[model samples]
Target chain A: MRVFAALVRQGMKVMLAYQWENYMGLVGNFAFLLLFSALWSALLRGDPEAQARMLSYVFIGQLLQNWTFTPTWELAGRFRMGDVALELAKPLSLPVRVLGDFLGRNIVRVLRALPAFAAVGFLMGIRLPDWPQFGFFLLSAGLAWVINASLYVGITLISLWTTYFDQAHQILDFLEGVFSGFYVPLWYMPPALAAIATYTPFPGMFFTPAAIFSGGLQGAEALSALAVQALWAGGSLLILYGIWLGGVRKMTVMGG
Target chain B: MLHALRCYLLLVGAQARAQMQYRFNFFAQVFSMIATYMGQFIALSWLTDRFGSISGWKLEEVILFYALAILAWGFAVSLFFHLVSFEDQIREGLFDRALVRPLNPFVQLLAGQSPIAGTGQLVFSIAAFLWATGRAGVVWTPLKLLYLLGVAVGSALILGAALVTVSALGFFTRRTYTFYWSLVFPARQLVHYPLNIYSQVVQWLLTVGLPFAFINYYPAHVLLDRAADLPWPLLAYLTPLVGVVAFAAAYGLWCLGLRSYVGAGS
Candidate 1:
């Protein structure tokens, strides 16, 4: 915990230096929200219930997405530069330290997105979730962080072996977005695609939380969703650990 | 011009072999690229499935918009990566190195990088274009066939010009990534849907100010034999001419921006 706190403090300083990027992200988010709101409102014209639910789904789904966003673009360079070795040489264990870094970055992102989400939500008529749902949302959100971090960091760690995935990265990014229900809620997806999305752990990232918050999944269904998310979270961490063992061995053999 | 074309081919050919050395990497890249490039089209299908059509444009018609845009953008990006990624070049000081060359920096930069990442996108676009042609029930004629090829080349030029124009801002500004995103994002995102969904003001803004419409929307409409909102439908045939003019204007901007560039001192 102490190590995590220290890392978070250090990460915040790094984040502060490049704060303008977050500001621009906020602007971009608002623009997309405005346009999507207009598009959905027009697309689902007669079905007001579905439309309202969708607006909330998009709003909260995208807001939470802002928190757990893991960038793949820099994976090739940062890992290739021997930075991973420096992190490994630290006194603490690596996965924990990386989690600390991930957590801290997300803290900054979530903080930046709050006002933007609030303004957009209010303007777009987002009904505030009840207290119970809000509490559950926080829980689901924590699990979501685990799922997203493990999945993305595991993929990023693959750069140790093959330092180039520029094209793969683009494809993975798109697949992740669509599968995670970030682009559209899985409910609205074609029946086959939606079913396929359910079987994948990716939906634990955004859709699970979005559904829980919007009360789309409730009571027994919500508990089952949380259980599924926990399953993915645990599964991802294990895979990440396994990948790290292999990657570390490769890195040492390469004499980096 | 012939010499420049030869140099571009030589540079790209050399790197293409190196990139192909890892067969596994090549296949993974191509497969992943197809998936990534399919995102917008997938969304278009899903939306069209639900809504029947978007603002009077049928699924096939909307797919036409998507396939053409991606095809052109892919070609532009693959061919003119230096321009598409100009901000990165500036940051890494490569743009300065290009400037110091005796040859035109534009040509030097264009000839330097060969990115095969867009190959999958181009292939996917072709597949989508054919599928859309079948679904949209458009009859083909020799002129239409000729027009399609012209539009592809013309749209590629227009997209390349836009990329160069935005990247030129890098010469005069410290950070132009957001501006690049601002320009490119709206073009790719909003342009996928029919122009009629947007307000008259936005339609006008896209048509005249940016002329992004000419890249795919106008040309696709003209080819599909759909009635467009343009006052003179004949203006549709002027796409290639418009593309040449846009590229020339953007090239002029590049020259102006070049004059202002004080190299990022080593």
Candidate 2:
């Protein structure tokens, strides 16, 4: 726990060093938000209510983007550079450190996004979620992060096989983004594609939580979403454990 | 001139050959690139499916505009994507190696990298273009075909100029990535959708401020025979002209920036 806390502190310090870049990233994020909001407004020209709901959906998705935007490319690069050999010699758990660092960075991102969220909420007239819904949203979001992280850990483990893990990451990253409804709400997706997305672990990462927060999924439906997320969370963690065991042996074969 | 062209060809060929060495990795990247872009297109289609036309532009028409932007950007980035790394080269004194060389630094930079991944984008865009054309039902006359060809070339040139101009500005500001992330990338992304959907101010910004609209929106409008819908109808015919002027300006800026280079750590 101390090691994880230290790692989180280290991540925050590193992110703080590049504060300007994060602000620039915020600007870029806002640009997309503006662009998409405009599109939705144009599409739902006559229906203000639906437009506002869709806007809220887009806003939540964009806010949670940093959480879902994992790039195992860094891990791949580390393996290629043999930096992982040194990392493996450490006493702490690799996956725990990865999660800690991600959490620390995300804490900063969420803090940075708060003002924008409030400002946009005022402008778009988005209502705050009720206490229970907010609780459900947080719970689902926590599970989503675990599933997402485990998915990335699984992706990073591909470094054990070949140096082309980055290429694989690029493909899976896009697939995850699309399948998870990061850009478009799953309810808005075609019936067929939405059905297909249900089979993937991605929707639990972004769509489920976003829907809960936006009040799109309520009560029983929201609970079902949480159940699905919890199932994915358990399944992905188990798969990650199995893969880590095998990947560690492969890592030793390569040197570390 | 002939000798320079020959050297450029040889260098580009060598780069391509070197990239093809990892056949499996190359194929995987290409396939992923295709899937990535195709997924974006699918998302757009689903949205249009749910809600009808966007600002009077049908799904097919929007797809046509999208394909044009993708093709132009694919052409530009495939050729000049390496320029994004110009800052590192300048900071690390690698620009000195180019300066000491007999060849033009611009040509050397162009030939230094391969663009196989962009080929996937190109393939997807072309396929989408065909699909859109069939559905949009545009009567392609010989003159229109010539105009389309001109537009494609011009759009590619404008995007390529945008890239070169940004990288050239790296000479003045060491951190061009910030400018790129905040400005260039966002502006470029907006072009993927129709400019008509945006507010007047945004349309003007995309049109005059950045000229990204000329890459696809105007050309698509003209080709779709919706010229009267444009604020200034004549703007539809200005893409090729805009491309030439932008490319000329970019070249001038590149020359000026090259002269400004005083070596790393200066």
Tens-place lDDT digits, model 1, residues A69-133: 66644544666676777767778866776777767877888887898688868887799789888
Each candidate's DockQ score against the native complex?
0.40, 0.64
Q: Which ranges in model 2 have alpha carbons more than 4 Å from their true place? A: A252-256, B1-4, B176-181, B259-266
Let me know the DockQ for model 2: 0.64
Best by TM-score: 2
Alpha-carbon lDDT, every model: 0.76, 0.82
Docking class of 1: acceptable
- Residue pairs of candidate 1 with colliding backbone atoms: none
- Residue B133 displacement (Å), model 2: 0.6
Best by lDDT: 2
Q: What i-RMS does every model get?
A: 2.4, 1.5
